[model samples]
Target: MVFSWRKKKPRSFNGDKKKELEIPRHFLCPITLDLMKDPVTLSSGITYDRESIEKWLDDGNFTCPVSNQVLRSFDQIPNHSLRKMIQDWCVENRSYGVERIPTPRIPVSSAEVSEVLFSIMDSTRRLDQCACLDSLHKLKKWGLESERNKRCMVANAAAAGAIAAAFDAFAGESVDKNINVLEEILFVINWMFPLTEQAQLYIGSQASLHCIALFLKSEDLSLKQNAITVLAELLSCNQKYTQALTTIDGINKTLFHFINKPICPSITKPSLTLIYDIVSLSNENTTTEFINMGLIPLLLEIMIDSQKAICEKALALIDQLCETEQGRGFAYDDALAMPVLVKKILRVSELATEYSVSAIWKLSKGDEKALMEALQFGAFQKLLLLIQVGCNDKTKEKATELLKLLNPYRPGLECIDSLDFKNIKRSF
Candidate 1:
């Protein structure tokens, strides 16, 4: 399916036309129709660019492109011979505008990965911090280069454990000179997400936990973001990790700083994600920390001014916070809380509706002013619309329950049923 580039005649410097030759057909990838820089052969016995074919397989495609046969495996065998030929061809055709393909770094073997891990560990213990950081940086580069290397690195049990040990070493030091190196180590760990169960257990240990807690204060945005991302992953590992994170002092304040100060969008996203994960864990002290930190007002501000994703996450945190009496009281005390809650009911996504409705339900029960305020803010119509259209069962139930709470204060259902909603677009 590859097509050759067409030659075109253009005026030369002397005012005479010259023809440009087309790229060779076999030199191009069948999938991309571009020169195959890193050629690889799949089980289908066809050669294609490694990146193009890997993308195809990554998207869940399993059949051969030309033969239409199911591939035996997604494993790609490097077409070393074909790649050498392509390199030779590109070198010979340099005058024709062909760029020589750089040699692809070979994926590391399991033994090589273990060797690197042990080397890093030994260097760190010997206080050769410079060498340890250099080895980690190299491993990080390899992991970023290809999915093959990433898998190999993760399979080596010592990889994550060694990184955690190095963090402990640096954090325990009397000087701050190696803190930047720790930041680089954190960045590498973030790249290798979802560590193995054993690795997670090791990294989530008390010493490593304390080390990462210190990283939360790092002035480097990348380091701080990576630290939070790793914490979120650790929280997902099990209850022990969640409990461990909950005990870290000032964790909630550190996370909220990103939201309030407004760093780059990359930092904001993970900061919010970590907040959601902490709240979702439902740890009592963690919830109290979030509430006592004046997070409700800040969350309301973010929900009001942020994009769709941040808005949804802000609302979700508000929802979880409302589950506690302290959270409910804090939210109710906020000037913008009720208006923002009712406005988000039908305006944001389904999850937002569910969370907002649940928050309103918690606030409106037996609170005459809050219930009346909800109805005054067009919540009655919005609730009926939510039930009329469609949302999750929990959302519908909360909406229905809130409606019942407002029943005594309502005029009648006839007006609600007769109202026109043709122009209203329900987010759910």
Candidate 2:
């Protein structure tokens, strides 16, 4: 049976096409007239679904829907009796294909949030791993139920504080065994974002961020991405966080670890983006460290197989990294670097191709091996083709310079004839 916005007619087993099962009027919200999944009574003593009343109030209506009187107070109490009655009715009408509404969860309250966070912090402190996991799981359930529940937890002092404390307890311990416990805590913390003052005091600390960065090595892809995302959120809160990120021990190496391993794009995008941002803040010493930690090879790895967006991200980062000698030297040492850069010249987006061309110009400057690598990979042919297709002035200059270098190597190379790029479709 079709459900109209104003009313519902769940089909009954009697199978009379036009016959409708009569529903009790009190079971419906006054505003929607649909069955109330979570009934609540307002200050006017008029009942409505909790979701409907909240939206009504959000829409700036302080008057009761039924009484049309200005509500003196906005407090809404759950109508448990009516909600139970509705559940019972839905059960009795199961043959009519109505789904019994699952009992509505009690919304998270500040005091209850404090209690759960206390459990997590206390259990972890005592090393009672099972009890700690149970409490974190409980809090995670509430946090996942609704946005309202998340706001309540974020408002609680213990919520973010305890999460930071829990991680502190296991900071340097081997993560392989506690990955499950870590995942649960991390997910709930993720929900409590736009960190409040209390939350930021703990999560924004360098100690806490270092602990969170440990999960970048997690073999579990989703968990690793969650860790990266959490880091991104916290780091975004303070520009100085990037400066702090560079100082953490093995932090750069761990971040580079996942980039070398080609995970899904969801993981790669944020991971690479964060890496790029952090490196952008690097001084001379930090830039050398990132290169030594496999930043160059990892970027080549990403550019080799990634889609347009990720490929462009990798190229852009490489272009920035190439500004330093260590970046250019490290990239030159990789045999695949020139070929990868040359291949991307005209294949990816205009910006990606431009970055590719620029990096090639920057890396091959006054270098024999780099220039030969570009020539060996047919960079000369691609460069000529890029110019004939009409590039930005800067790119045209770079492409023209690359052509001059390659001309000595492959002077016979010319743009491919009659190239109708209008029909040449690229996934990237």
lDDT score for residue 254 of model 2: 71
User: Highest TM-score among the candidates is held by which one?
Assistant: 1
- Model 1: lowest-lDDT 10 consecutive positions: 8-17
Model 2 C-alpha lDDT per residue in residues 1-428, reported as the tens digit of each score: 33234453432333234555766878878777778899999988889988888878877978887777899998889999999999999998776667799899877777888888888878878866678889988777887798677777777755776786676565535455666776777777777676655556566566557767777766777777778887877666655678777777887777676677657777777777778778777677877877877788878876777789989989989998999988887887888788789888875789998899999999888887777777777778777777787778999998998888877766543333334244554432
Cα lDDT of model 1 by residue, 1-428, tens digit: 43222232221121122656555677677776777888888788888888787777767878876566799887778988988998997787676666789999776778888888888888888878789877888788888888878877877766777777676677666326776677778887875667767658666776667777787777776677787778877776665676667677777787788788878777777777778777877567778877777888988988876788888878888888888888988987888998889888875688788888988999998898888778767788888879998999878888898989887777642233233345677555
Q: List the residue pairs that clash in candidate 2.
A: none
Q: What TM-score does candidate 1 get on C-alpha atoms?
A: 0.80
Cα deviation in Å at residue 34, candidate 2?
A: 4.9
Q: After superposing candidate 1 on the true structure, give the runs of residues whose Cα lies further than 4 Å from its correct spot.
A: 1-22, 42-45, 56-64, 68-101, 124-128, 155-158, 169-181, 276-289, 412-428
- For model 2, give the 10-residue run with minimal summed lDDT: 8-17
